[model samples]
Target: MSPTTPHQPVLLRLLHSAIALLVFGSLLTGFMVYDRYDKRFGTLNLPIVPNTQGIHGTIALTFLILLPIFAVYCFHIGDRRLVQSQSMQQLGQQLTEVGKPIWWVSLQRLTNTFMLIAATLAVVTGRMMQEIWLPTGELNHIWYIGHLISWIIMAIGIALHLLMSTKVGGLPLLLSIYHWRIRESDLPKNWLKGFKIKPNSSIALIIEFVVIGGIALAFLLPLFVTA
Candidate 1:
């Protein structure tokens, strides 16, 4: 009789799904919360969703709590593969054999790391502004500045990550996160095995542009109109 093989770890798949849902939901909810608190910014013009602040704030807080847990899980995965090694030689050796091309290097990883850092800062500042830290109005300016700056930095970091991923085969990487049927052979050996190479999807690109444009109009137009 043949021995049964163990099931592949579902943690990665779960993490990917959780992160996607949390981040996307958090962003949408954040928009609603901002609109409610600062109605001077004008409505988001989203289809039928009105006054989403309550929902958004609840989700954002939940996401904020979940992010660190996800981070720990991801680090565990990396550690199992020796991707988080302290030795430079081990790191270089691992990088050389990563699933993606050589062009996708430490800099790309660094960008991702920085993006997470910036996102954490944004969340922290946002919480402070929402009075999670202290009396809300007491430190409004400082918290607002921190939130805005961190948000801008995170946006830039996300943009760069997307561009670089596209430049060196990010389509498959993104798709793999969404599509569960992808075979193990079709993916990087591990989280740190690197991203997959594939052409960018036009549909995804268009959706991103539309969403960003809507967000910009919602947040920026009011400033000029009120001025």
Candidate 2:
């Protein structure tokens, strides 16, 4: 079976779907909160929800919890795809190699990595931001600025991720993450069978570790900040 068409493993599919839903929820509520509370650039004409801040905070909390779980799953089960190829030549060659097996040495890796980074930024900055602070019209906090930048990064990263996924794997690959059917062999019961770390160079591993550490720090840093 082609990499693009193979049935996604059940466990991974579940995790992916949950993460996607939470991310979407977080993004939507986040936009609404931004529009209602902070319109420094240009105000959105959409109906303002008075409670959007609460909704946004709720969704952000859920996203924060899910992200670490997804990160661990991706790191262990899917880290190879997050790794970049050593050379631009290899990446370029992979781009040209349509119909080749799905591997880490492609533009998809770049998009995936960027999306993870953006999401991490969003979660960290979101956590650092206070709902009361926004309602008071205080838009000058460093963390709030970081959160705004993360929102932009996340928006671009998500759009690029979808576009590249379509170009590389088409609709089937996209749907595979949420597909209902799972072959018995691909069931959760078989999750660990024959599973092994996908080959990645030391440099790739190091990069992945650094990114993960950054994400961890993002989640933990606010705890140390004094009021």
* TM-score winner: 2
Taking all chains together, the TM-score of candidate 2 against the true structure is 0.84
Candidate 2's residue-wise lDDT over 132-178, tens digit each?
Answer: 88889898998889988998888888898888777767888777778
Each candidate's lDDT (Cα)? 0.51, 0.73
Candidate 2: pairs in clash: none
Report the C-alpha lDDT of model 1 over 14-125, residue by residue, as the tens digit. 6657766776776666655554454444676544365464566666667666666555543334322212222223335555565444435444554555565665666665
Candidate topping lDDT: 2
Candidate 1, lDDT over the whole model: 0.51
All candidates: TM-score: 0.56, 0.84
User: Where is model 1 more than 4 Å wrong at Cα?
Assistant: 1-9, 35-51, 79-101, 131-140, 182-227
